[model samples]
Target: MKHREYGVVQRVDHHGRTAIVNWYRTYTSTDEPVPQLLYESEMSVYDLKDHPDFQYRPGTVVIRVANFTGEDANCTAGQ
Candidate 1:
């Protein structure tokens, strides 16, 4: 039940408290194809601005990829 993060940015939705980012899974250990649609939840635009994993550049798209296992499922389950 682990959620693995990945690369690729396609769209950004900021209607709710968290920013909904649409991205693709370009890499995976499984035999599935790459560039698949991946889900990102509970991400805020403000948080992305100060995230250490990625830098928010001017006019540049910022994405935060996180992996949440069953133990960490609470962090990204309802969004």
Candidate 2:
């Protein structure tokens, strides 16, 4: 992957700094926890490397977080 700058602060905040993106993740499971105060910062960023159409991007390797069967996951895991 190529190098690019990213932010640690949420996009909707009044103040923001482009901090090193330590990592990226997505959780479709209802078991995951999200505090009430954290609802604003979940904005998306665009990445031309993956999406040529310039869709709303979260800057993460896209994992099919929903509706993928277990066998599909195992196959990708082997790659």
Candidate 3:
């Protein structure tokens, strides 16, 4: 599976076991289009915060989506 690496977490939704993560997608290639999505996953805020690749800080926008786990391919967030 292939996953694009460009996004920022706009918000975190915790209504159930899965979280609806609002994110702003980014593109590396100029030809690529930017995608804004609300990805739903089982990952928690603490999980993201503890991620080695993801530097989760207050007001810290995600500029890249690190493809560490292949599970990321199953995650999708969009209007």
Q: Write the per-residue lDDT of candidate 1 for residues 28-64, one digit (tens) a residue.
A: 6545434567565556656644324545555986443
What TM-score does each of the candidates earn? 0.29, 0.20, 0.30
Full-model lDDT, candidate 1:
0.50
lDDT of 1 at 31: 50
Which of the predicted structures, 2 or 3, would earn the higher TM-score when compared with the native?
3
Determine which window of 10 residues in candidate 2 has minimal summed lDDT. Answer: 33-42
Error of 3 at 41 (Å): 4.4
Pairs of residues clashing in candidate 3:
37-77, 37-78, 38-77, 38-78
CA lDDT of every candidate: 0.50, 0.36, 0.47
What TM-score does candidate 2 reach? 0.20
Candidate 3 on 13-76: residue-level lDDT in tens? 6664334444444456545445545353344655554334556678666543433335555655
The candidate maximizing lDDT is 1
How many collisions per candidate? 0, 0, 4
Local lDDT at 60 for model 1: 84
Q: Write the per-residue lDDT of candidate 2 for residues 1-79, one digit (tens) a residue.
A: 2232222333433254222222333344656532123122343333212433324547656544444454663454325
Best by TM-score: 3
Q: Worst 10-residue stretch by lDDT in candidate 1?
A: 1-10
Model 2 accuracy (lDDT, Cα)? 0.36
